[model samples]
Target: MNELGSRRLFFKYAVPQMVGLLFNSIYLIMDGVFIGNRLGRIGMAAAAISVPVIEILIAISMALASGAGIMISDRLGRERLGEALRIFKASILLSALVGSAVALLGNHFCHGIAGFLGATPGIHDQAVGYLRYIVLFSPFLLFSFLLGGLARNDGRPGLAMTALTLGSLSNVVLDYLFLFPMDMGIEGAALATAIGPVVSVIVLLPHFLLKRGRLYLEKATIRWKDWLDILRLGSPSFVMEFSIGIITFIYNVAIVKNGYGEIGLAAYLVIGYMMLIFLTLFLGMAEGLQPVFSYLQSVGNHGKNDELLSFARCFFLAIGISCYMGIVLFGRDFISIFSPEEIAMIDLAEKASPVYFAGFFLAGFNILAISFRQSTGRTRSAMAISLLRSVAIPPVLIGLLPLILGRESIWACHSLAEAGTACYIFKTTRRNERWEERWENRLPRYTVEDERTTRSGPSTSRST
Candidate 1:
């Protein structure tokens, strides 16, 4: 990583992650498409409404994974190979415990949870049925996600990408089989998603077991300090992932309350699914960049770290603008894939698409800002950005905008929130130098001798 040019390093990590994430999103989109076509509009709405419940679990897994992964990356960068391996083992064990707890609670409260998420009577039963299976397999899904992060941080990005790809491909195959051949309806889509992570776990197990990188699975006690550190670093990521669920829930309630009803909810789902593709680009880039940023910081390569951030800002902005333009030109066709027979739903989604997505042009800036902070261990700043963007801002805008500007303004809420957040991020970036300076002290400084010594150790630790 230190020897490579900035652009080369960016592409080396970001491209595979982007491609893998894109492919992962394909099966998810496929699940939505199959459900929309086979089970109709209410089916699509049920799937969308269930997202919050799913994301809550995913948020927990990601929080633990991202937090521990960042810590592991930093430890390896500091030549603390043994410490890194311990963090990895502890992370897996904690994830399993959390997954077990969720499986027990989530399955028992599936119906209540579905109703609490604002599922209308028409879709409530279906939502409950779909959610049950998703929660039942929580352990596999959580571990799969956690393992991917650890593997990527261990300098095995290719393996991580491969695991995600294989799992998603299997999901697509299973989605088709269960939904069409077996005629299982919405339940089949849920089961397909639940099963994908199992495949991921299978593919990723070898990275640790075979000792492909600096980090390998080993016996480790769960230390409170380690868990706290992981949670502190990872809390922002959890919020980032959790925000999607919150945003979806807010939009669903807002659309329904305004009398737009199921068609509007269905419309939101279409746009949301398409947005997922764009989100994957930003998130994949951020995840890919995290280890690089952590490693650079650990090795005291501040100049390279800043340069990479600059490149990320420009790269993400260009991608975001290109995506919004593409959406403007081809949105109707995209929406049609999900709701081919429902002209009203398609029309509603198409109309809402531009207004709802205007923020895409500026979203990359905000995402990169949050990612930079998280990667560099600016946990407080990262958490603040995530909370404001996902938690605080959405509700106020979704609630107040419609009251003042009428229900049509509902579509503008997300756009306005993102634009506003971009301004905040710009200001925060300028003022963050002091905090960055403070955080820099905590990371180790490696000299040439230290690097050589680290490399020559029993289990050589090298920054990729």
Candidate 2:
């Protein structure tokens, strides 16, 4: 990475990650499509009710993977290969243990969980059916995320992309087969999603098994402190992901309270698919560049760091503008993809589109800001940003705005939260920049000891 030019490095990492994440999100969107077309509004609402559970699972997996990835990247940057390997081993173990616990507990309590997620009596059984399959296969999903992140940090972004792409493609195929010919319905969709990660795990496992990069499977003492460190560093990512579920849950309640009911949920589900694609793009870019940021910070390459940040800012802004425009121009068509026959749902979604997505132009930058902070060891700042955007602001706005304005004002909550958070990020970022500049000036200029060590090329040694 150090040897590559900034543009090349950015593309090298970001493109594959983006492609992989895009494909990964495609299967999720496809679920809505299949449900909307086949099972109708009731099915879509049921699926929506189950979304929080899946998001929570994803959140836990991402937190562990991202936290461990950051630590591994920093260690690799500093040439501490042993420590990196140990963290890698611990991460694998932790993911397995956590995933199993979730699966067991979640399956046992699927009915209660479904009711808690705001499922109506009509959709409650379907929600439980969908949630059950997902929880039953949680381990595979967890491994998919953990190994993919480790692969990226291990300097094999392409491999990680390949694994995810394969998984998503397989899911699409399974979704069609199970939903149409087999007539499996909602459970089929969840089953397809759950099995997709198994394929990804298979593809990624060999990289570590073969010792293809700096990190690989190794026997190491798993300390409680390492677990704590991983969770601490990863808390922001956890919040960021978990907050998706939180937002959905809050929005579902708000929409219900506003008397929109299943129609609202079905419409929101379509909009949520669009949101997922855009969010996946931002997340892919941020995650892809995470190792680069960690590496630069570890090596104290302030100049290069600034250059990458500049490029990322421009890239994120362009993407955000383009996405918002796309939503404005073709949102109706996008909504129609889910259920063209459902004119009421289509009309509702179209009306809600602009207001709901109004401030998404700033969302990518906010995500980038959080990722940059996390990679550079500003975990608190990252957590605060994540919490503000997902947890603090959005919910408050969702609850208060509807009462203050009209019931229709509920659609604007997300946009307002995003816009407000962007302002906060801008202020804090500027302040941090000034402080960093002054701090750098106070220190003597230091040169990198060796480009090779700093680059931290792939490791071939095996550990047991």
Candidate 3:
């Protein structure tokens, strides 16, 4: 595809996936509403408390799928379909195994954390009941996310969209049935969430089995090196994504220490749902950009790619602006869905969310930077960004902010960390060119794409 064609193709897949995922987001919000309305505030709070874990699972799944898919696409361009296919198959197996373990182990861990999130005796059983069903469905959730990523990279974003949409919609219907029709209580809500992914998988299986894509999982492709590569490529993402859980735990502590309780928990949950929406958009763009970045590199259009990266930065700025506008205009509407009980809670959340999301504009930049680093196989650079932004920054901000500014400083950590991460990302953008060059010659570019016309900027979404 030419420059215009490539840009068009990028939007084609990006927009639909965006819309389809919107439905998925709505379903989550709806589930929260149903659970909150049916279950008591503590029960609702318990489910809300599980947000970090949910996001962590999502991040891990995305890391594996997107990271592997990025490499697979690059390999396909290089005509190493065998290696690509091997990685694809290995990712699925690894994801399933890991997901299964999480199902078994995650429940008890969640039970341990429940007290912190406000799961008292009254709501305790309901909370654990909710956790149980979702744990059982972990494999499907893992499969759904991985398959969605694979479908996107394997050149059938429609398939991924179908899977995601089906899963989201099915979850809503099943939620109503399980929660209301069958009167399964919190367990019903959990079951619905689990079932959603199964629907998604059903939509995706046909595409892979039919061999309609350039890269796919084949029986011959399951190999250790390939699995290692997927893990290697995915590790930065795993760090970046899973750190959300770690950081969120920190945030929860801050919220509690700062004295919010179930009220605080509910407010955070409201804010979290909105964050998820913004995060999904940010992730979608970064993911969509990855394949484009890889494709351009393979074809030797580095300069033009540099231009594309600049344009993407500009484009991302527009996204940030839109996010800010969404928060300002619809923050109340969004939060009310989760915490309809207290107007004061809504007002407080409204005040905090904008500050938290103000750095959202910068997050896209961080995401862009991270995407570039990972796509080109610059593992060290990728990992540095991941550790700094995901692990290091949040904790440092949480630790110092409280001591320096007093307890309320806890509330400031989210925005403070985001701003800090953005600064580090900006610095990396400058130094990363040299770093990328170290891997430049190491990864063969000419093997794929019409590289002659394809321009790659500094490389990865970071430098790109």
Candidate 4:
């Protein structure tokens, strides 16, 4: 990290991660495209309504992985290899237990849960069909994402990227096979997605088996405290994931209520899929920076941390602005990819593109800030920012705007919510500087000294 300029280091780490996550995001878009083209707008709406289920499952995995990933990176930085290994094992085990339970329970109540998530009568049956396959294969989805996070943190981002890329490519080919030639409909789409994780796991196994890496799993007594530590550190990530699920759920219901019903929802799905693409880039950059921040903070290298933060902020701002311009200029073409001939949905989304996407420029910066806070031991600030952006703010704005200004104003909800939170993050960082100064002389329980690698890499003992 010290060898490269800030820009070079940032891109070196972030680009692979960005590409990996882009592939992951493409999984979502591919599902949308296949479902939209074969199953029609109703199928698209069914898929959209089923998204909350996917999000909730992703939330669980993200919470465990992100929390443990942070702790593991911190331990590795301090040369506490044993502790890092323990946490890693515990995280994987915990994910399995939770994932199995969700799969079992979700399959049993698949239709009921679909109804509970606000699937309208017209789309309810298709929604259940899609959700059932997704839930039954929940273990794969959860583990795939969790393992990807772990792989990234274990100094094998290239492996992580490769795994996700292959998985996504498999999904695209399988989606076509299952959806078109097989005529299996919505369930086929879900199965294609469920199969993606299996591919990722296949690609990821070599890392653990060959021992071509730093992190390893051995027999370690899994403790309740370790699990709690993982959960506690991961709460912000949970909130972020859960908030998106809630927001998606709420948006589905709001679109239906606005009298547009299925057609309106189809349009929203197009916009939502596009949002996923942009979010992956921003999220990829933040997650890529995570290890660097954790290492720097462990060694008390605040100056380097400050520089990274600055570079990331400016970099994402430029990316976000560039993306917004592209969308404004070529939105119809963008929307056309999902449903080239479905002009109604395309026109609706294209017209609302500006308001719908206005927040991305600043939103990119806001997303980076959350990751920054999480990496630097500012969990409370991170959680607050996460809650406001993902859970609290967007829903309120989405609900209130249509009621007050009529339904046409609904497109502005996300932009307004994002802009508001960006302002708060800006102010809070300044306030946090004062708090940091007050506590600079004191070290928290979690802080540890830096470790130097031996010829073997990631030596277990710290340098004296």
Candidate number of the best lDDT: 2
Model 3 residue 198 CA deviation (Å) reads 0.3
What's the best-to-worst order under TM-score?
Answer: 2, 1, 4, 3
Task: Compose the digit string of candidate 3's lDDT tens values, residues 1-464.
Answer: 23555457557556556666677778888888888777766656667656656766777787788767877778776778887887777788889888989888877676776666567887777777777767677888778878887877776767777778888988888877887779887777888887898898888887787877765566774777776777778777777667656766777777787677866766776787787677667667776666667766766767755766676677777888798898989888878866577988898788878767777777777777777778766777878877877678887787777778886566667666767877877776767667888889787555333353366533333211
Q: Please tell me which model should have the higher lDDT, number 2 or number 4.
A: 2
Clashing pairs in 2: none
Over the stretch 1-464, how does candidate 1's per-residue lDDT look in tens digits?
A: 89988898898787677877788888878887788778877887788767776778778887888899889889999999889978888888789888898899998998898888779998998988888888899998889878888878877788888988999999999988998999988888899999999999999998788887777777766688888898889998888877777788789889999999989987887888877888888888888888889999999999999899889888998898899998899999998876588899999999999998888767677777777789888889888888888878889999998999999999989878888888888887667767888899888877676677777864355343
Off by over 4 Å in 1: 41-49, 118-126, 433-464
**For model 4, which pairs clash?**
none
In model 1, state the lDDT of residue 301: 99
Per-residue lDDT of model 4, residues 32-107, tens digit only: 7788789987887788767777887877887787788889889888889899989989998898888899889998
Model 4 bad stretches (over 4 Å): 2-4, 119-126, 256-263, 340-344, 402-406, 435-464
| TM-score list, all predictions | 0.89, 0.90, 0.85, 0.88
Q: Whole-model lDDT, candidate 3?
A: 0.74
Judge candidate 1 at residue 134 and give its lDDT. 86
Model 2 residue 216 distance off true place after TM-score fit, in angstroms: 1.1
Per-residue error for 29 in candidate 2, Å, reads 1.4
Worst 10 residues of 2 by lDDT: 445-454
Compute the lDDT of residue 250 as modeled in candidate 1.
85
